[model samples]
Target chain A: MKTVWTQKGFLIPAGALLIAILLPIFASEYALHIAVLVLLYAYLSTAWNVLGGYAGQHSLGHSLFLGIGAYTSTFLFTKIGLTPWVGMWIGALLAGLVGWFVGYLCFRYGLKGPYFALVTIAIAEAMVSLTNNINFIGGAMGLEVKWLGNSPLLMQFESKAGYYYIALVMLVIALWLVYWLSRQRFGYHLIAVRENEDAAEALGVDTLRVKIQASILSAFLTALGGTFFAQYFTYINPRNVFGEGPSIQILLFAIVGGLGTVWGPAVGALVLVPIAELARGWLGGSFAGAHLLLYGTVMVLVMLFMPKGIIGLYESIRQRLKRGSSAPEEERTPA
Target chain B: MSMLTVSNLSRYFGGLAAVVDMSFTVEKGEIVGLIGPNGAGKTTVFNMLSGFIPPTSGEIIYQGRRMNGLKPHQICELGVTRTFQVVQPFPDMTVLENTMIGAYVRHPNTTDAKRKALETLERVDLDAKADKLGRDLTLLELKRLEIGKALASEPDLLLLDEAAAGLKDTEIEDILTLIRQLNREGMTLLIVEHLMKVIMNLSHRIIVLDFGKMIAEGTPQEISQHPAVLEAYLGKDE
Candidate 1:
């Protein structure tokens, strides 16, 4: 009777999944690729939301985990005969370890607010430089996955549908993880720490430990997405994985959709990715940076008008409607 | 036996002495009142005793153990818990969640913590608003929640910092009755209050502070009659 699919929060996700499954049948190859891109961005934003939105620790360097995951998994798969599936877990572990270290250093030293944001940015830049200079895993040129000829063992398939399905599964897992955490005791503790660290500490909640746990959990999930991306594209580059673009993309979707809400990033990705693809298709040749300009304007408007993001706006309207209907019912009842 | 003892406790903020040479002892199952005018270091004493701000010099013995340098949470774990003057409830959490955090000191398991938290909320008459967000609580409810939180820790020595401040007369009376009940239940309490009637009526013995110094210590009737206490209150420039 209490099936996971029948839960209150699963409705939107279930609908999204149904649409994702059905779209490939009617969509063009270009449209399918856009859909894949949307899934990828959605996954990344949802991963970032765990730490940025739920924990109230705004991270601008989430690509650090993505890069680490991509490189670690790809390196293992190429150097050894290991499958990408096994490498995915390894990458997640490494990323989680690194996140733990970073969290410890930042929280221990009381690096917070804009200063913490700067630290993440600096780390992202540093990771990029480090990856660029490292020669073992293809260095600045990047790594390419060997063609496996539709081998399920290697997680490579000839069809784009394979990639789409994989991305969908990942999106589902990420969404589930966020939802589970948002309802747990750990989530409440994370929110308390986010709202006021001193008060949380005084109340016997280990603020530092909670922050570190959130960071590590967030990194682990984001790293899995990274490995999926590497396998899906069969390519990995420092600019693509560790670059500012991926970081900004993750933060943008999370913010534009609704940072702390369950479906904020998914909704953000769904809205933004299609528009971006359409813009690129129409004016990409003549107007080079037009898509970027449009994105910037849209983001600025979203921030100014709907500070809580689109989902927040939707919720407010829903609440008002419920109140309106309930008021009339109460009036008629004459309590 | 003394539940809490502070000797030669001093705290310096930059060049000024906020609390100096403060020494006191609270017996088990006694209600002791610390009364002072604004900025007389009443809160500083609470802060030092509860390990919020470490004393610049001296020792605090709680249950015959030195507690001067321990962290606030550690001190809380040692059966000493304090409520803030400004009431620092976790604003994003529900009242139950906030209280559960306090209960976590004694009961680490979620079920046990919830059970304890509920019992403590009932003790403070806050069980009705258990599901309400901390931010949505009224001033009276907030104060009750503050006390409820300290109670959740199962403290042997409970410190109250202006728990009755900014309440209606009836609300204050309600809180006073609760405090009396808690005291009657064999809980040791140290209360800081500006209201003379509440302090005089509630405290068996009162300690008065003026200019960060212990100006007087006596029964409530003696403190009211002390010439120096009256001068300290009246001599201040209005």
Candidate 2:
């Protein structure tokens, strides 16, 4: 309520938005593809941050929602001859329901911290193996999304620009959603539960409800990203889309950016995605998996500089600047 | 009239009895004190009353509703909330934000909850430190923050678990004043403390527990003079 958006805050985001909107218009195909990937990961990371960061519930099964989104919309479009735009929403709904069920069982049984993380990992892993064996769901062969050539109605496009813009829009929407949530009562409940469950509960917070709601909302958004990925890439597979790799990758974006902060994941995506892609390109044939080494090194360096992530580092610097220029430190830092 | 009724409450951690047959009633507007030595099941009793832990073989009735099987949040919503014996603050949050979390229980709007939280913070003299993160607060500040957060829930029966355990004498006096002020405003409190002087001055009635069982129950003067109470605190002479 105390005016979270300062003039500088408004200016920075507005400037960033202008750049993001205009970047696709004049970009080359390869650059646009990278931009699309960056936006896509930004979207997924934002989704994961809702629960993993804000609610303090680390979930490694987010790829399940992603696969569900991609699979459901793809199935509906291929089988029922429906447009993907509508199917995407249905996929989101189904994922939300599944997320709620999973969250309910976990919170109801009081699964917390590492145990909860394991359950999520186990669920995603099971989905991976199950999708591989299920014949109707394309089994290990995977599913290909058929594009009828440049149709806006189908949410498919011949130009990478379209996907880039769409992914950018998704990223923007996800960031706004997190910003809106952080300023709401429900958001406070999620953060409280995250900070200390017992204290939150004693103070009249419904920790279970907060966790469940966060899980569902997060899944819904992540699944929407999945649908977008399927539409953008024109293909989906259990091993690639629902694998532990995607789940971990998405979380890393949030973690590296600053887990609890609204724009942290988006910032993370913007900064890390391009660096990783460039590293991969530069290290293409000289050595296998060398790009990952560079990626890991960058992450380590960033963490060494700012242990809480980029957003945290920014906040601390800003705080110190304020204290330095305007006033004295109010009290000594706690020991 | 009884605001809280604990009948035959007992809690066992595996084979060890932490609270044994603890039965007491807190009146609607009195400050009731629970005092015992360390590990005397004081915190266990507080946990049961606040619905953090269930009583093994008893019932907790709060304002005509059963509270034994209820969750802590549910009990809080039923107008009973408590502070922890060991101070627990939401370290990442600002003082106002930490208090706002409790205020959110009643006021479902962010703006409204913040306003309520601010009012509660002011009550506990923490308004000046509202912008500071919980982790930045000093020890005494954290203790006040613990109480401030609990008070934000607007509970009819406030359970204070060792409210003045780690405070200096002057700091304890500040807490006593706050408790008195809250009681004067018609708030009922059930406090747990180790210090005799603090508890004797604040509580309308004092209950003593030893080995998870009630050793004495009376007014401050009476309880201070009770033989069983003396035996519990100082070993009985042969």
Docking class of 2: high
* Candidate 1 lDDT over residue span B78-147, tens digit each: 8888898998888867899899888877787778889999999998899988988899999899999999
Clashing pairs in 1: none
Model 2 alpha-carbon drift over 4 Å, by segment: A1-6, A328-335
Displacement of the residue A47 alpha carbon in candidate 2, Å: 0.2
Q: Please give me the DockQ of candidate 1 compared with the native complex.
A: 0.48
Query: What is the C-alpha DockQ of each candidate?
Result: 0.48, 0.90
- Top candidate when judged by DockQ against the true structure: 2
- What is candidate 1's CAPRI-style docking category based on DockQ? acceptable
Model 1 chain A: lowest-lDDT 10 consecutive positions: A196-205
lDDT of 1 at A16: 69
Candidate 2 lDDT over residue span A1-335, tens digit each? 44646556777888888998899778899898889999999999999999999999999879989999999999899888788899989999999999999999999999998999999999999999999999887899888898799998999888898888888888888888899989998888888899999999998888999999999999999999999999988989898889998998899899899988998998899899999998888896788899999999999898788778999998999998988876543455443
Worst 10-residue lDDT window, candidate 2 chain B: B1-10
Interface RMSD of each: 2.1, 0.7
Chain A vs. true chain A, TM-score per model, equals 0.94, 0.95
RMSD to true structure for each model, in Å = 2.9, 2.3
